[model samples]
Target chain A: MQKDASLTTPAAIRKLVRAGDYSGHTSGFAPGFVQANLVILPKQYAFDFLQFSQANPKSCPIIATSHSPGVTDMPTVGEDIDIRSDLPRYRIFKNGQMVEEVTDISDVWRDDLVTFLIGCSFSFEEALIAAGLEIRNITEHKNVPMYVTNMPCQSAGMFHANMVVSMRPMKPADAIRAIQVCSRFPSVHGAPVHFGDPAAIGIKNINKPEFGDAVTIKNGEVPVFWACGVTPQIAIANAAPDFCITHSPGHMLITDIPNSRMAAL
Target chain B: MQKDASLTTPAAIRKLVRAGDYSGHTSGFAPGFVQANLVILPKQYAFDFLQFSQANPKSCPIIATSHSPGVTDMPTVGEDIDIRSDLPRYRIFKNGQMVEEVTDISDVWRDDLVTFLIGCSFSFEEALIAAGLEIRNITEHKNVPMYVTNMPCQSAGMFHANMVVSMRPMKPADAIRAIQVCSRFPSVHGAPVHFGDPAAIGIKNINKPEFGDAVTIKNGEVPVFWACGVTPQIAIANAAPDFCITHSPGHMLITDIPNSRMAAL
Candidate 1:
């Protein structure tokens, strides 16, 4: 925890990961900076993936992407980013299946690989906490409960799948406030898509999630669902791109851009 | 309905009301202008009621007040406005009990009366309609169902009572959109206070309401509750002021101010 507190800046955290010193999840590290989900794929599938992101902005809001196919410097999001080594962990997928989990991807770096930085929930979670709302996952010390809903995403070329959502239990009053707070950050999955009955969205059981661990839902609290960053991953896997890479579940690429800069209003 | 279409402007509606030509409810008339709730109290009770409104803004957001006692000219809200006869109808109360209902209060006008213009839900209702969300009350051709909740209002001098909330039935997805739409108009009760189960807010039966007509709650729809303008009236009645006047339930004081002007953002 002390080490976590020491890595306060995005640059410092990226430096630690680049030096092979820190290889853990980047959840609470670099508090105020924006942490993004990484999705690297061969340039052959870049246009279709970009179209899919635009069609489903709520599920996959794109913040920035590789300047050209393998040029690794994302100056728009960070100062000097080495896409292969800046993140703590990376997952390599071959033919729609994860083949290897590695600390760095320098060995498999391809000139035609396109890096995508999609917005993550961590930004809005930080905003919600600052507004004095309790996130159930944070309180229970577990991953936010994620589920694949019957709500389908708009198809783009060959990329198409059902939307994935992450749930957080909140009292109705708090949920109302969360909507207002999240609405300002449209770049990060703006507002919740649904609340109340989980079965209404095709979730048979609230206790059993398909993707992440379930958190406690108190008596009066309702489960509010937001379009998760994981939706694109599911779509990508379903598309069965010949080669692709993504940051591991909780690990993400910390950016120099402040979360406040993402506000729409 | 043709007459309503003719009376499209706020000034025209106020003119008709002032001339004793139109004495009907102002809902759906003068669509874009702000319609306010009227609360006229004697100078002796003005300070306490003002304090009460300030303490509970969500329930009683004050848009304007008379410049001074006996001064009916509210130039800020409109041009040459007469507080006594501008509304379609008025209700007079004596020692907390309703004594009479009339079209014009000029006959009983006093030099000690102070006028208070409060924000009404009509502003946000317009916004919801513009956003393409159906307002159940409007669809059913009934008054919005309102219930007296266990939620307590902050006590101010000689003013204290339980809160009153107006309910609108909507699907969870539409309810989420309503929260965002209403949040922009804080002067008109802002966002919904509670949603889902009525028992959570102390309403025993969803169909039975203490005030206004109940609207239908469809199969997948949930009851969304917002702090109502009636809350102030309830508090004032509970306080039992020596003499007071207010607009009749559906009769509002139409102002020249546009509905968009009420948006906080």
Candidate 2:
């Protein structure tokens, strides 16, 4: 799908996604808006999931949850949003494996479902870019390389998984600036968890990532890693709930909240 | 030579230093209070010196300046503060070279002198310590290591010199937390300029520092550097005006203002 010039605001973009037409990566789609990672589970698992997010805020920062399961008017994040079908794409899972992919889930929407919007890296990436720091993945025109780390999440109920991290290579100066800029948005994976010597965090090879494409790390540049939104997905898969759904990688749910609105400073 | 119990408050400490009895390192003295770096110059160099501080704020963050030349009291930072004798020790310089070291400058106090209080690292180090981060220098019982860097300060009139930085080693996670904690005290150097590599910032050897004793860098820890208050002193020494007086290393002006008062958050 090419760029949809008509989809200017997040509402317009969501309207298109709801109408079953636009299903592509949401990057560069909504310029100043907050893009979130989506997770849908049965209401029975809601409390445990919320606990999981609170315990590991860096990996799974819960921005907004459904007011009550089944009703989806998130006035705080959007003007007229529907959790069931407002995202560009979603992956459906059954017993720990991805079963199918879809643009909208209105047909499968259920009253027992609870929607969670986890803060995405797009928000912090936008901040870093605005600060004049170059993002390695964006410059290389490749997916951000992600790795599974040795760090374990504080398990909640049946959910248990190791952390997944996204890598960005930068000079020490740029990395320092990035940490300051990213610190403001705690909801968006505030600050890097680790940098330099990938082996320190159990990343055996810098070039071969478990997910996304590897970007260039120059001589002076070190690989800075952030707690990834994908960690919850890994957790969900490990738990292997009977049914699960999450936004397809890079296809986020763009909300009305401006990126600047997320800054704690 | 030892922690003085009688010097309980900034006023009491000032009185002792004023009476020529307590002349020693101000660290851990008057706990929870602000200990400031003192810089006094001839009136001819005040405006340009202030401009230099304003330009290179990270390297030379000026918290307060004398209301006007010839004034001895700085009520903004402390009440009944006698600038001429409050600090434990003063270094008198003639044409950029140290001419004498004295406990008090009242004998040579001039009407054409202006004083400035630069924020000290002790403020943020206290905060980091409170947060359970180990300051390597304090842990090793040595002065924080300092080095002259190739990064140049923005010159103002006759004031000009390369920036000097202080180094502390920490694991990557601890370094991230330190960044967040130090960010709240922008008056005290704000965030670090660089990390990971020493040569990138023009430091030839980590162990062989220009000022202060070296601390241990553990197997997994990396040295984190901050914009040292020494930069302004270096700039002043390079400028080589007719006369100047500054606090001796570790001899600071104990202010009534609490360390909590300096937090910008």
Candidate 3:
């Protein structure tokens, strides 16, 4: 492990992760900074995914995409971001099926590969915590409960999926406050897609989540849901492109931007 | 009605209202402009109300307030907006009870009066309508149904009340689109407070509203409720100051600012 792995700066963490020393979840590593979900695609599908993200911002809010295809460093998000190696792990998909997990993709890096950095929930979760709201998943030390809802993302080109939402159990008042706070950060799955009843969005059971671990639900708390960045992952999986790459779940690219900067206000 | 009653700009409308000529609801008059919910109080109560608004932005979003006590105009929201008579009507409250509904309050105007202009849902409703979402009340030509919710507004000093929400029914898809559209306009009661079950928010009867006329909830439509400007009225009524004035229900003060200007994005 690198000496600076514990440091909260995105550059230091990316350096440690890039050197093949740390390949684990980036959660809790870089507090107060924006952590992004990574998506690498060929230039051919770039416009379609961009259009898809534009149409469905709540699910796939793009913070910064490569200025042009084959560009490894996104000057806007950080100082030194080598998209091929900065993330702890990458999932290589062949026609939508995960084929391999690697720390470095430099060998397969193509001049036509386009990198997209999406806003992650970590930014807004920090905001919610700052506002004194208890995040159930954080308290339980578990991944947020995620469900595959019947709600469909607006189709753009070939990308489409029933939206995947991450759930946080909160009291109604806390949920209202979360809505106000999260609404200010549109890039990070702004506000919530649904709340109160799971069945309303076609989730049959509250105890069983399709992804992530379920946390304890208190007496007064209702499950508040946000459009997850995972929705695009599911869409990409469904589309089954010839070749694609993504950051492994929970392993995000920590960016130099402060979480406060993500706030649209 | 005067020849330019509908044709007049917000400044002209306020000018006419100031001169004690027009004394009707300001709706449908300023087509592309903003309308405000007026609350004028003594300087002593200003900080508390501002705190209350900051704490509960969804219920009482303060667009522009008197820069200093006794300032008659808010240069940010309009030009020459006289705090006393720009509104079509004003309701005088003593100990929280409405004592008079008058066209003008020049007689009661004091040196210490601090005026607050709150964002009204009319601006966002215009945006929603432009986005092709049907506003039930507008279509039925009735006041939007408003209900007192069990949800409490965060208290600041002496200002607090249960939140009041206005309802508009729409199909699930339209409701989703409305959410996205309203999310862009935070100042104007952005997004629905609660949707689906009114009972969730302590609303007992869908048809029986505490304020405004109840519109039909069509077969496939659900009642989407928004945190209303009326919420502050309830708080003000509960707080019951020695002297208070508000715009009469539906008799808003239209501003020269366009509705699009309120979109935070």
Fnat for each model? 0.97, 0.84, 0.03
Indicate the worst ten consecutive residues by lDDT in candidate 2 chain B.
B1-10
Candidate 3 structure quality by residue, lDDT tens digits, B1-265 = 5646565688777888888887888778778899999999988888998899999999999888888888787888889877777888899988888899998888998889899999998899899989977888999999999999999999988898999999998865576567768888899988787777788789999999999998998776778889999999888888888889999988998888899988977
lDDT of 2 at B204: 98
**Model 3 segments more than 4 A misplaced:** A1-7, A40-57, A62-84, A105-116, A151-160, A196-202, A216-222, A255-257, B2-7, B10-24, B33-124, B127-132, B149-165, B169-202, B218-248, B252-265
* Candidate number with greatest lDDT: 1
Pairs clashing in candidate 3? none
Residue B64: error of model 3 in Å?
8.2
The superposed Cα distance between candidate 3 and the true structure at residue A235, in angstroms, equals 3.4
Stronger candidate by lDDT (1 vs 3) = 1
Model 1 TM-score (2 dp): 0.98
State the weakest 10-residue window (summed lDDT) of model 1 chain B. B1-10
Writing each residue's lDDT as its tens digit, candidate 3 over A1-265 gives 5445456678888888889889988888878999999999999888988899999999999999999989899899999788889999999999999999998999999999999999999999999999999999999999998999999999888898999999998876577668878878999999887776688788999889999998898876778889999999998988888999999999889899999999888
Candidate 2 chain A least-lDDT 10 residues: A1-10
Give candidate 2's whole-model lDDT: 0.92
TM-score of chain B of each: 0.97, 0.98, 0.97
Q: Sorted by TM-score, highest first, which candidate order results?
A: 1, 2, 3
TM-score of each: 0.98, 0.97, 0.74
Winner of 1 and 2 under DockQ: 1
Instruction: State which docking tier applies to candidate 3.
Output: incorrect
